[model samples]
Target: MAEASNGFFSAYVDSWDVLQIPRIGGFSGTVELPGSKSIANRALLLAALGTNPDRSCILKRLPDSDDVNVLRNILPALGVSVVAEEQGVRIQADHHRLSASSGEFYVENAGTAMRPLLAVLSALKGSYLIYGNEQMNRRPIGDLAKSLQSLGVEIEASEGGCPPVRVSSDGWKSQEATIQGRTSSQFVSAMLMAAPLSEKEFVLRLEDDPVSKPYIDLTITMMKDFGVQVLRKDYQEFIIPGNQRYLAPEQYEIEGDASAATYFLAAGALPGQGPVRVNGLGRSSIQGDQGFFRILESMGAMVKMGDKYLECSGGSELKALDLDMNAMPDAAMTLATLNLFADGKSSIRNVANLRVKESERIHGLKTELERTGASVEEGSDYLIIQPPSRMKSARFQTYLDHRMAMAFSLVSAGVSIEIEDPGCVRKTYPDYFLDFLKVAQK
Candidate 1:
């Protein structure tokens, strides 16, 4: 009942009221999505790191979102010039010096920025401080910090393994950086990005099985796209040769956001809703979240996949499924809500990491699902849900998490539901509900 902290979104959520989601008989249209945030942010940082002496790197179809905005703003402060162009942004790095003026850099709840930058700034030559909003400061970064420290980087954490990280390094020294994968894969991705800039060849040894291999693969693939080769032996080890530099291409086009596409895909897969086609991410999408459609297919949805588009239809009688969704946590949240339409109980497993996300996702989903007249049971690493005999209208609280607001919107497919803090979608898809309405007409 009490507000979390005085962040920008927190203030905005205080004055917001419940948003009633539109209930439609079916959906039949194509939704054009913005670029992938995961890819966009990674490319932006890579462009900054790989920029030639005075030359520039260009990227097209960048996602215009809060997280991207935060990274765009932070780059310039670190001495990278970001020029807005016709279709994309041009990044100009200081060729003479890798370390620009470094001071306190604030990233508001962007795990992508905070994690990667921690490893990156540690590889630079200046004393830098990185901090984020109240929520981000509470998220774990110790695993990443310790790995960097083992590589001879001077860094400090505030209290726990959380952020407000301070980095003082001459440069990255060549050493075997061992990191655990049980946490977020962002840790591995962060070090991989910074490993190339180290003084000697770098070998990243994995301690445990990684959670999201696709994201790590995405990072490696993009690194290679920029002309750097990473020798990977399964997910256990990654070898990056030292003195390597990132080469910028003429331009790179970002793929559509697969995580964002799951909502519409789910809509189309629902019993009454169907034939929703989403453009952007396709069969060749490098993003792992694209696999979410396979889950839908397993649940009996008819899906069509193309080179650059995906369409879903049918599933008049949806069936429940038990799935391990650790690979696609964000998309899995949409599945959690979509389970409401299933005829029997459903189970989502291997998502204990969800507890440390924007909010306690597992607990939040159970609470909100029960509030909306569903029978739910929560566990340390999983959720079990039994669809209600009939649906009931309820106001679902989002707990200031964007995925919660977006995932819960699926409840409207079966019953009318009101979402609290609807503005929270601005964290990623600002026009989400508006876009949903466009394709949701029968």
Candidate 2:
């Protein structure tokens, strides 16, 4: 078996420094989070699409992470002028067209940048080469390629249906196509983002129910916010009138990241810990990952939520749960660790897509949990976790996945554990351990 492809994307954390987890009774405190990665990438691309030839658009409170940074660096290559500000970036795109006749882009492991850029670039007049890190190249792009081919664009994927993609375009001809969604919702979103620019009315039909369906909703909602309307039929189909254009607003403020909040929220819910309040996301949060707090509340955590904030306090005991997590795969990883503290076994289902992430998450969870003295069972689309009678100290391997590092960090509360390649969290939450330490200090 090969080592997983996810690891440090740039010079930030290449040393693979071993991080020792400090034993703590509990964690509770106020921690402000960075902006939403999903929204920031989408908004940045939309800003480019909607930019007038004469003016620039400002995006505030952008996420400071490697995935989002990929978009920032690549934008200028495509003729988008970017000015780094104190909080975010100022972008001005000239008619949303590439400055050069052809371009080469290295997106590293940022799927958000690669997938969407694939769709948008396919419609422009250019020859483009889009490649990523080994881990990203391993993630499938076939579905998106087939969908683009249906619309009369030329694209070629490697033998495994992965990246190192080559896209050549004069423009597209077809107005309608059907794409499957069993693998990733990003396939659907990529097409939607590029649909309005089609030469004719565009209609995209899904062959099956989309995994991570809520992300598609985020895409549609953000598209509307940029002044392009998509006619949707029950999440199965989308219709975009041809010749429509994205309208960039004067400035857009990004919301707090709900996925990144999972650690602190769970820390507050650890038995005997004080209440933890997270600002930036609340009842009004558009991110589907926010539903994670609801899962915590269901499992006996006391949660108080308002329009802009949420506080969670550990219950007398954490209860085991059996539930589907297809809509929130990233956040659901936290549940695997939380289940370790439950009195009985817990189950998670409808997450087959997790296998294709930065690591084989289901297998990784089973292997690492067993190392900590827990009984684990793996399924094609699910897992069942049986808590250990007493946690055993172990050195957990992060496998280059940020979520893996963060989820396993929770084990330190039960027993002091060591985490290998802990800096991998820089992919999303750069100061995750620092913030966790802050909460633990209280």
Worst 10 residues of 2 by lDDT: 1-10
Residue 167, model 1: lDDT of: 89
Worst 10 residues of 1 by lDDT: 3-12
The parts of candidate 1 lying over 4 Å away from their true place are 1-15
In TM-score terms, candidate 2 sits at: 0.95
Q: TM-score of each candidate?
A: 0.95, 0.95
Task: Write model 1 residue lDDT over 1-442, tens digit each, in one string.
Answer: 3332421111234426667654555677889988888998998899988785567888898888888888989887777888889968988787634557468889998898899988888888888989999889999999999998987788989998898889898887756879998889999999999887774788999999999889999999999998788999999999998777788776889999999999999989987667999899898899999999998998989999999999999676778999999999898799988898887999999998899888889999999989767899899999999999888878889887989998988777766667888887887788787787767663
Give lDDT: candidate 1, residue 313: 91
